[model samples]
Target: MSCLPVCTQRMKELAKERELEHGKRIEWNDWVADNLVVQFEKLVFPRRSQLPRASAVPHWEYSCQRLNHAFVRDEYSQLTLIPSVRENELVLQFHDFETMGQKSDGEIIFLDDITQAQALPSQDSVLHLLPAADEPQSAGYFCRFAIRDRSNANAACITPLNSGLLSRQDRWKRPRYAPSKPIVIDLSPRDLGLAEGFSQAEFDIIAGLGFDSEQDMSWRTRYPTATIYDESPPSVLSHMRRGKLLPPQDVKAGVPKVLIFSETGPLVIGGGEDPYFDLPLLNIINELNASEDDFDFLVSIQPAGILHPQCLPSFAKAVLELLKKRNSVHVFSVRLPDHGISNSQTYIVLLASPICSDVPWPATHLDTKSIEEQICHLKSKNPRADDTHPTAGKHVFLNPAGQVNVYNHGTGQLPDATDRPYFKTVDFESNIILPTLYSDHGWLHPTRHDILTVRECARIQGFPDDYIFYGADKALRSQIIASFPPPIARGIAEAIRKIIKEHTAPGLDASTFAALNLGGRPQKRTRVD
Candidate 1:
């Protein structure tokens, strides 16, 4: 018998005391020596020696409460049979035994057909009876085991344990953390260019957008039916196949019920920004309409990218081409300057003008006034269309030298190098200047120089204050926001909801669908005045 350190110390102490009392130390066979050993063993291994109670840990009911809604399963709780120590009992050890058998002449004798039979209650086996933490002491103190005949499990002598049950009222106790309410966006619709009616009161007014991640993981869980279609690191097909995020379906099943694209059809399907007008996705939609069952779904796209400024009108044309009901296709985007026209037009003027001249550009056949005057008129017509200012914080810089330094307001332009709080984004070779969100910096706060923080970018995109983004870096979070602005998405969704409701209802005229002004492609705007 090996003694613990404390036990060894006490044994030596006892020997020394006995030597003082007697001529020599006490013998091992002596009654006093045996009593000391037993006392030491008791001290080494002490137990609370109390009856098991439900309060030891939260009962199985509490474990169930830890589960998400409709996520309750057996993994929450477990149970296992741990054999207690018994004296001189014959325990047969079978390492490779799986069949039901009995011992006979140093060999195993199988009863009945043993080919399909299996051994139950293996040493490592655990039964998940309830979703609760395992308590070894509870089994030791409260459970009682009875031997049952292997041949007849139905006639087993085991008795039920009734102590685990709690009162009926206790079963409905609240969980440690309550579930949050779903976000609801109520929208008030109006004519085009008039969305600003609610801008002051309803829509969040913030500057800049960011995109760091492709998929918003929260959206997958929050809105399971909403599927994001993008071509990137994780292909749309691969993303849809990931379990729980999308419904299990074959590739031939065609498009999902609700597909959301952060960018327009051309950007996603391929092709660069020079001529940002294409219809690969729209063509697919047109083909899908050939069969009634093929495209019975709603497709929403937000084409607010600088490259595809005309995405709304382009998508509108596609919807117009649809032979079937065009109301199912919707485009949700902010009105911005068309880069194809805006950037090229500005670049042309910059090249034509004399660098030393006070005037910007010469007048053309289109306008009677100078090119600068024409530009000013266009700017006044589209007041909020200037995309050049990196930050929303605007300033008028006046220099006595009058050195002409023009910035492309159509594309994002950084402040001068000498300016305080200045930051320069990495350049892209494909384009002379970076597009709306591709640039490195944004003006989010009224007075800040560094790139927009993730929180500020989220605020600009109309994400709720409480909404949390899942990502490792600011780049990933920025990407997600730039691609999908919740405010714009909500507007489109609201429009779709109304269109769907009206489309399905009886006595609704086909002409009314066109009158909604939410569907169909749009043409270039004529001068209002």
Candidate 2:
């Protein structure tokens, strides 16, 4: 495997890891190719006389690595883009690659001419950026290539086409047309890749992609679509205290939310595994304070020791001070006089989740009650999705169903990924206890069991199923499952933030702000025993 060694070595170098961190597994990489080109490029063409066989359109993908950095402090990210067939117009499809896996990046239809087209096509999606198994720094970059020449035994030489140059005639056609006399470009680069980690030069190179000076003005253009924001002011708790909220906010400027997800702790499959789950969240909070992108009307979410009630007021004060220089942005914290909420407008979203789904489910084999009877209330109001599915539920709609989850799928940064959690396996036999249900809808708790399955829990927490986790053992599994705050809760907080901003901003109607886009396919409900 000459190709394998090179590919493997190159990927490692890019990630900047000298050796594989303990428990880290490479997921897989995906290759993108055009279907029409695959047919035309073939030597044994179906005889014009032989009717085209009824079959799926030919398409292709190349294998990539899947690394579930379930416990790595520093994370790696990759972005892929595959454009559909079109004329000279520069239409681009984008994807965020935080996870590892062979994703279907979409088709790469070739065009004949550039000058021939009258208008650019609207964003015809291939796939949205999935969340990697790991979370990535908010400040990052991505690139994409069209897969070419997969037919060769040596797949290393495959290259992508530069859309900047194309002829006009090949842009469009009827059902009868095909790739006539044509040209092709190599999509893959000759070398695997060079250098590791971001430097000044590397950073600049990645940043320059689609460099547009006018992007600032277009950042948040006025659109007919109403914005979604968190309506309640943020709840800032101290980690030392580790509890709930004091009260509410009138303006609801900002609230610090703390999320507690159970995990197997840290693992070092190799020498030792090292992943700081809360690092990215912390970094983002710091950024919100330094910037003035209407970022104020939102409360910062963080990881307070045991819970969010313990979040420090010092952080809020510091953030407010940072915005002192900016004329528009200003976020402040509200103090409570007593035990209840300080004000009715205060918002506190306590996102608590188990590390996995080992929660002892009573009916390992269905008998009296249907699976719908096993549905998790915390996941959805619907009780029939997971347990009584097929009859009551159409598809799983527990927590995550966003274009954003695709961007974060497989790299193992996230603690509460749907497919894989931070800790997959935990020594149930080794632990001090056996399986038992912890709460109300309780059947038999799987140790990691709460109200939802792993995916169901992830969705409610705002993570797509494709997002992978780390920790392959039961102890680790439980840890990852319980460590995260629910995504639904986060989405709620996000909505609340936006609502507060709209109300505070002059002329913006409070009624309009209430119409935030937070709808999704509802989960089905079934009666459980």
Candidate 3:
């Protein structure tokens, strides 16, 4: 084999070791050459049919290093391939050089027109130049590549070269024909009627604080359709919080085509003196009216606050009434069993659209009784009782009244009969899990006789095990308890997607239509030839 002088030294050492182990002479040079050929073929052959032709190639980088070895082989020296754009075509220049500063002849590959010499499969190879692996367990080389489109400099796709063909089954696809710009307004307590003793200015300042990094990340993952704006000045949130309408220029720039207002908490109707029970809703509505930038659709999810017969109009009912006045509205109820209080709770979801005269409500049926029976069966089998989980196998004592026995750990004794007020144990066979699972006097595990862990509570709320929670244990527990179930949310999302698909005009993009109807401003319709 004609090996580079630098590579010969390392190959000689390896050859000597192998010969000694086999107790025979070996033609190491020929073996190395054959191995290199096999490796090159494996890397280059599979992708021969996939490469696009006559297209402007984006900037990309490919690198390979010797696997499980500190030193790189002479043939595996870094090769920098840079592509320059010429006449809207990609011109890739390939350069090979040694670390010792010796440069070899260079080659240029024209994407639009490849020469006969450059058209060879071996010449077209980029990853195959790396050394071949000797064993199944060991990779001959580790490869990495990145591609960045010139039009979107900030966006880049990076992946392992040996990742093979990735499956698209797990990819999340947005709703087709939906609005291009959708905004989510997460209302706080102050945004509604409950101020918790804070003044209006103070409440606005706190509401304007916006989400933290973790929250921002979680929200983006949860609501892929919603547009999350930067918290910087002159943002949509800033203008909305200050009770100011978006300027015409801003509206024309990227007006929100869909608006989702979310509020989840225990609110009371006529509980406070504030006449405007839904200040945030009113503010947004007023702003849109002033700007004339009506959203294509609006969705609201809010708790059915403490009901009062004398309150006249509850927040949920009032909001529904207001929405119906402006556009076609569909309403749905989401029921949640509050195990902590042994009561059934309900929340309202409203979907409103301007262009569509009638919208179909998303059908959702959750059988709490059936779900409870399944939970009971699983608990009887103790499926989750394993050493891996924190709450597994832990025991708690419950009284006949279904209250947990609060043992005083300091004294190592049970509290006196009078001191131990009966507390309810969570009835997996009857009641659904509630957010108050973290409360000291709240429900205990139906079978385990212990407080429910964050993950256990989250699972009961229809959250996947992989969904991450950030913060202290207490905070995580609270978040899991307070969240709206994912199953119901998904059903609602699917319904909205269907509505968009049915209502949108064919061949016209949603964003283009939105721009044309900006602020309800009338534009002369010109016929295109």
Q: Going through the candidates in order, what is the number of backbone clashes in each?
A: 18, 139, 4
Rank by TM-score, descending?
3, 1, 2
**1-68: candidate 2 lDDT, tens digit per residue:** 36999877776574444123212322000000122123223311121222233433443422222322
Q: What's the candidate order when arranged by decreasing lDDT? A: 3, 1, 2
By TM-score, the best candidate is 3
TM-score of 2: 0.21
Poorest 10 consecutive residues of model 3 by lDDT? 196-205
Give me the runs in candidate 3 sitting further than 4 Å from their true place. 1-209, 213-256, 269-279, 306-325, 337-343, 364-366, 369-423, 431-441, 510-529
Model 3 agreement with the true structure over 393-463: per-residue lDDT tens digits: 33222122343332111111222232133324566656454332112223455555544455455546655
Model 2, poorest ten-residue lDDT window? 188-197
| Native-referenced Cα lDDT, model 2 | 0.23
- TM-score for candidate 1, residues paired by index: 0.29
Candidate 1 per-residue lDDT over residues 46-128, each given as its tens digit:
21222233324322332222222121222221211122233322122111112212221112221121212223233223221
